[model samples]
Target: MSAGEQHGGRVTIRQVAVHAGVSEAAVSYALNGRPGVSEQTRARVLAAARELGWAPNIAARSLGTARANAVGMVLVRPPRVMVVDSFFTQMLSGVEAELNRAEVALVLHLVDAFEQTIDVYRRWYAGRAVDGVILTDLRHDDPRPAALRDIGLPGALIGGGPDDFDLCGLSSVDADVAGTARGILGYLRALRHRDVARVAGPADLLHTAQRDAAYAAAADDLGDLRYRVVHTNYSAADGMRATRELLSTAGPPTALVFDNDVMAAAALRVAHEMGLAVPADFSVVAWDDSDLCQITVPEITAMVQTPALQAELTARALLRALAGGEPTHVVLPAGTLTARGSTRPPKRLG
Candidate 1:
């Protein structure tokens, strides 16, 4: 016998069968822990295995189980840039927490482009590399959910709209974007600001569309309040550029609202460079309040979006979806507004 076969004493199923006084097939069933073998036969097989010091091949056992014991996550952007966003980080932390409790591992894949994201999902589903998937950064007409549905794989969306595309009733968790926008507008209107300017994120995002629509509806309801909307790429640099352009206009708005804290902080810096005072000269309010809110000179008053809570809910929804439950739509209420020094009654124009 070869060294590889001899070291363990060539303890094959036939040998176990002879030692246990059972047929080879019965020994095989018992050794594999299959249900066909009687209890007495199984115990005899185990005793023979112990005497021979034989062990089942781990690789073969795993193949028999046919389970990866891991969940996949696909981020629709560059990993480095996505990690910088506190919202993503917090949400991921929440996912990790839940996954840890379940003793499962998270397999994260970052696709730099949209096409790449689609390809990654396709391959993952075909390969059966994960038990389920988590989809993030939903666009207006996302294809991942459909692909997952076609493949008969379980998945959950982190952000999506009610009427937006879904893959055969896949579960989705949406942030209260409309309510968030309305809350911000209500706060500004309550402060007696008649004109408000908004720096919005990418128009392709469903949340951005929802926010924009809500803001427009609120402004119309207020009666006589002027509204200006500027769409940007949700980056600090874009926010700074938009703020500069908006402030330099012929009739600059008295108050500015940003869709994210990164842009809001950039707007604060722009205000400082232009020698404009916060609140006294202009009021500002930011959505998705994060650490950046407190870092600026005049702390920004912002609408808080709890990423941790979103993540927890998303994890639970995904688990339920994986278990073949009906699709669930959870709409968490909008976060409370944290009042800071960045907003006040608009100043009198000269």
Candidate 2:
């Protein structure tokens, strides 16, 4: 309802117009900073509105302002995994905080299947469920960008721009995923570990692809050094199994890098079960340094990736999209090395 026809709130724009002795359109124009009304009339209308204690209802504002007053994020990952994943958990908290400051709401949903994710995105746009959306966990040749464009929905990507993903016409807040890998490998190399391996997340993810490429390049840089990448989900169980297999191999790596803390902790536990001493028999490193990294016998060394910062910037990008801001890119720096008990100079056993 406009000021004239109001419900829910105590004061209506009709009351303000009556007090100002002006037509409702004139009052609305003055109050909204539109050009139709003179400065004196605008001031009078504003005063009248203030005196009436009238506030725009968000529900009514949404209808008139072409805004849903909420942003959407549809996660392909399940809630069970999301709770344990420090990256998502911390990132969401930052996103929520930023959105709160803007007085916009968040509509977050998790899908049990990948197919449902596309449907949710389409429905959210077709039904005006959100003003804009934040896309994450992007994959190779992802179709969501194209789908979003087709439906006239606005979105901001969590990864890089056109170079990193399809992107289409969206802006992005990119993380230094490859740089993080380089930092991890560089640290291990400095510790005199010639053989290092990575237990990474799913291969299809764009970030994982970037990290994998970096790992390969780093291996090439260290002449005669051995490196291998084992793909796994960001799960403790997968981490444990991968660690067991890597350790069982002959002339296994002297150091290991995991995509996340959960996997690193799993690696640490497996190393213990195999009667191998951490930082001696094997050194461990994780991409995101979280609380899980410190709980182990030898606190895991990790890279200080700021997932919260990434999420904050990503949220801002979505806000820009909602405001019809031009598409652009923002690249964030990679995580720095955080040396801990789980890393040391290479120690070899016969």
Candidate 3:
């Protein structure tokens, strides 16, 4: 049998170096297309590697001049959210689709806090476990970008606009929040519903802040409009509680908008429990479309942001950054509000 066959078909760089009659470091430099090796040495290394059917082990290659050939993403959310929210699943599908095409692996982690998330990044960087990272749920004056920059790690931000992190050198992808908020509020106003309240996600989140500002501006632009916002953790329980409180108030909003479909579904349950007629009593709108919206009683009006497309764009931006391309921000079209049985003129007007 040949010497190569004796190694059980797993040829190491050391073996290639020995076969090429060169130092292991020289073989590594040559194989990885680094600057230290001459063309003759590189040719010899390539010939030796090919003859032995040798392939670079990703972990070992990462220790040398070669890239890790993988990217990381951390979700700082309760584990339950991971299972209940289809948004992450849809977004991951898009990211996976892009990474699969590029032959790169995705290292995903779930953590409960930002501090833990940061620790993960530090550990990943120290171990050379990833080429770069993807960031989500950007917060006001977020320290994550700075942390990544300090560690010299390349990154991309999902769910942020062109105006975010201008100096930190992160590529970002975002939908047109200002336009989406305007569209949703305008539809309600057109239906003669002047008192509208928003069930928003965490106040510190950049996108939620953006939505708040946009909604406020839109409400101001429409004279005689009364707008209010309540913050939540984007959970079904919070949605039901907030919905119950708002509907219980003596002069509550004539319409309500939720940050996600799960919350909107909760709002529907709240309406039923309170004996309030959807659309006839008050209207409901959800941020993202889902099966829950359609299956719920009095199907909810919702905004479709096309999460898969958004995620694909974000993944492409990260890939470009990893390839030493200039970082750029990409903005997708705004969410399209789909009117359903859940919205109409207020009872007084109807």
The prediction achieving the highest lDDT against the true structure is: 3
- The per-residue C-alpha lDDT of model 2 at residue 304 equals 88
Cα lDDT tens digits for candidate 1, 271-312 = 889999898878989888888799888999998787787777
Give stretches of model 2 more than 4 Å off. Answer: 1-12, 16-63, 77-83, 161-164
lDDT of 2 by residue, 1-350 (tens): 24445445577566777888998888766654446788799889887777666775632452275566788998875635544777777879978988986767899988887668778988887777788888887777888889888878888887763364568788788887667777888888878888888899988787788788778987787676789989997888888989898888988899988988899988877987999999888899988898888788899898987778878888888887777788868889988888999999876632
RMSD of each: 6.6, 5.5, 5.7
Candidate number of the best TM-score = 3
Q: What is the Å distance of residue 59 in model 1 from its true position? A: 6.6
Q: Give the TM-score of candidate 1.
A: 0.81
Full candidate order by TM-score, most accurate first: 3, 2, 1
Candidate 2 Cα deviation (angstroms), residue 266: 1.2
Model 2 lDDT vs. the true structure? 0.80
Task: Give the alpha carbon lDDT tens digit for every residue of 171-258 in model 3.
Answer: 8888889889999999999999989999999887888988898899999999889999999888899889889888888898999999
Model 2 pairs in collision:
3-13, 3-14
TM-score per prediction, in order, is: 0.81, 0.83, 0.84
- The TM-score of predicted model 2 comes to 0.83
Clashing pairs in 1: none
